[model samples]
Target: MVKMGVEEGEVMQHSMLTKSIERAQRKVEENNFGIRKRLLEYDDVMNSQRTVIYSKRKNALFGERLDVDLNNMIFDVAEEIVAEAKEQGNFEDFQIEVIRIFAITPEITAEEFAQGKIEGLTDRLFEQAINAYHHKIDAIGALTVPVLNNVYAERGQIVENVVIPFTDGIRGIQVSANLKKAIETNGKEVFKSFEKGIVLALIDEAWKEHLREMDDLKQSVQNAVYEQKDPIIIYKMEAFNLFKSMLAAMNKDVVSFIFKGEIPGQETTSLQARQVNQAPVKTIETKAELVSPTGVSEEDVNDGPKEPVRNENTVGRNDECPCGSGKKYKN
Candidate 1:
């Protein structure tokens, strides 16, 4: 049921086709076939990457081994941070990024990591991140139910006052205080739901960003041909690097937002589509006439025996003037 674009229902007809007609229609123009072959070549490259992302999304949606997935996300974040720090030859900026986003202070420093020969750097970072998370959970204890219920109650009251129209067929429901109290009483399950939401939201945001960058690269990579470079080769290399960066970003964003008690919103990563509609067109009319060397009018020439050649015979300076009103040819 997936379609490239919406189609009018009137045009969506399925007709019975005979075997003979089907075979005859298979004879495509060579040029068109070649064009499609080239198109698929580029599409194959993107398809492979798209498959991996979609698989990940399916897993998240189906709640498959979610706890293990969360653990992997944490490790991924740790590894990415360590890798970046290693590349930059310093951890000051790394620490700053982590602190600013996740609100966690790592006791380990870049200088210290260098001193330790970079051993167990990832483990140390993960431990610090986990500790920060656990501390937040402990702080929310006992008062978690009461706090969540109060927030949900306020939201329910607002929903009762505001009239929201139904979309398609279904209308969104506001979180009621009773539902919130039930969730709070359910204990760890409620928080697990929150964590899952955060992770999926971050993954979606990061993937969208990666797709946007890839699209931009696809559009502009042709400029490489001016330098006698292969655009496909350049695209593949850049895409690989971009995918790696996307994974790292997803890992970092998920963990950071979860620890910060926030969900990544559309405002964080949404991109506006640029429209290039055709400009308005205007048409103008003008009249043109040809004057013959014999001083013949355009209408007279058209009405003559045949079309007159404008420059067939030249008027020499010593010849009589072709125009009857002229005094001399050179005058």
Candidate 2:
């Protein structure tokens, strides 16, 4: 019985393979049009989100203006936090949340917040956040942009790479410096090489986690129909919420890592995603090569061989042959 069962399983596997191959053969015979259409229909929704994420990353990687980018992100985060807290009508919770996310305690006292309008309270919070950032930079003599260098031990030498952090959680590297000569040669490039690697690292890490969460969310949402709800509608709504949450989390993580995390050095590396360009290769076609064509390509058929050429230079059936043999076409 065991042997029989194993044989039956093998037969089923073979049958499945046979079907798959037959389908593939049909597709080829049709000129591979079926394959193209299938690819176009697959994972279209996910591709849109992917494009947006990649565009954000690309902008961060190549954008030159760090201050403007950082300022915008900081403002955006502040706006989100303020908006979230506005409904609660609790200034204290707002302050606490601000400090928790920005790592800067608001200087405004509770009494002052209570005495003032919400707009005033928010302005005060923004002021404190900006001041806190300025103060940190002032102390580090990084009143301008802060350049960072990564230090690592390599072959009895200290190697350094300059990393720059822009505001949008994208980082750039200038050049690597040799530790032995770094002190003697404090070139602009050396300082320029210093960047904020932590921001991009945090954003990328958070985004990846968000994608994983979304995948799980999607898989679990198929059960929504069992609850007497439309799964498609539920999935779309939940997916949107998930994306918004992911964006919020990314901003918060970027801020937290930038302010509190240690600068990435040779021990740490830049967080730029590697870009690759790939294209499908075309192969030489043979007479026997089958290609699947779609309905449009095969719909029209005027059977038999097409008309033969009868141009000005060509001989007609009743005219003499081109060879000038002086023979009629019938002859």
Candidate 3:
């Protein structure tokens, strides 16, 4: 009877130990699962943003109706400018913005702006913007077609592609087009290339920078936990705002570049070459010497020898002489 009781006690103890370990294992697994789920939630946010940016890039890259895309951008820019001007109650600023963005002066007068009946102003500006863009394309085509033809005549059999340079004041890219096709299409093909190149370039740059910002934002928002805030919520809100701002800026840049870009002419090319060749202005750094109230310059005071400070007991004139030639008094 005693041996049976001992065996039963040992088995019960072993069972309890095994159950404890199992419970701990399950708890650890639950913790790991929660961590993975949270990580996935964070990644989901970036995935959505990635999807949006990639979709835009795809459309710009492969879509047949790029002009329609450009037109929509112009209309949006016009609307934003008008909205801003209305908020500021300044029509002069409106005209300035129009000229800056579209490179064309606005015909809408200040009085018309003041009357607050500018509902059709956005549409009007859109039309003007479209016209200006077409005019720019025509001008560029006129300038380049003769040169293109000359090149084609010389190397029609050997040359299949021509490189065209496009610049947006800040950056330049070379776009290649089928030389024969450019001539056949009367430079329409080149224009399309320009549109696609500009859109893709700006989108790529903006999206890349936005991704960097998001990475930084994700790290920074982790500190929100110290403030008893949900880091994910903060990240979502801030990320949305950043994405919107980036998108707006990218759209504006695309529209501005398209509207303002031009094929470099001989004079313009020479001017650019000259500017590049010119020496950079030498900035002379002059250090200003600070003068003390006593008229000693700070440099002189600092560079000159520092006097040793005396902390010896003061010798009264009547009490006599620390010089060790001491008489008891004033000699």
Q: In terms of lDDT, which candidate is strongest?
A: 3
TM-score of each: 0.55, 0.50, 0.73
Off by over 4 Å in 3: 1-13, 117-119, 267-331
lDDT of each: 0.60, 0.55, 0.77
Ranking by TM-score: 3, 1, 2
Model 2, span 5-28: residue lDDT tens:
665445454788799999999978
**Candidate 3 or 1, higher lDDT:** 3
Those runs of model 2 whose alpha carbons end farther than 4 Å from true positions after fitting are 1-42, 64-66, 115-120, 142-196, 227-229, 262-331
Residue pairs with clashing backbones, model 3: none
lDDT of 3 at 31: 100
lDDT of 3 by residue, 1-331 (tens): 3665675445455788799999999999999999899889889999998998787778779865677777878888988998899889988899889988888998778877777544687877888888888888887777667767876786567556666777766677656566778788778777788888888989999999998999999999999999999999999999999998998888889888887777666432322112111132432212322456687776776896779998987767688676777686578
* TM-score computed on alpha carbons, candidate 2: 0.50
Error of 3 at 113 (Å): 1.8
In terms of TM-score, which candidate is strongest?
A: 3
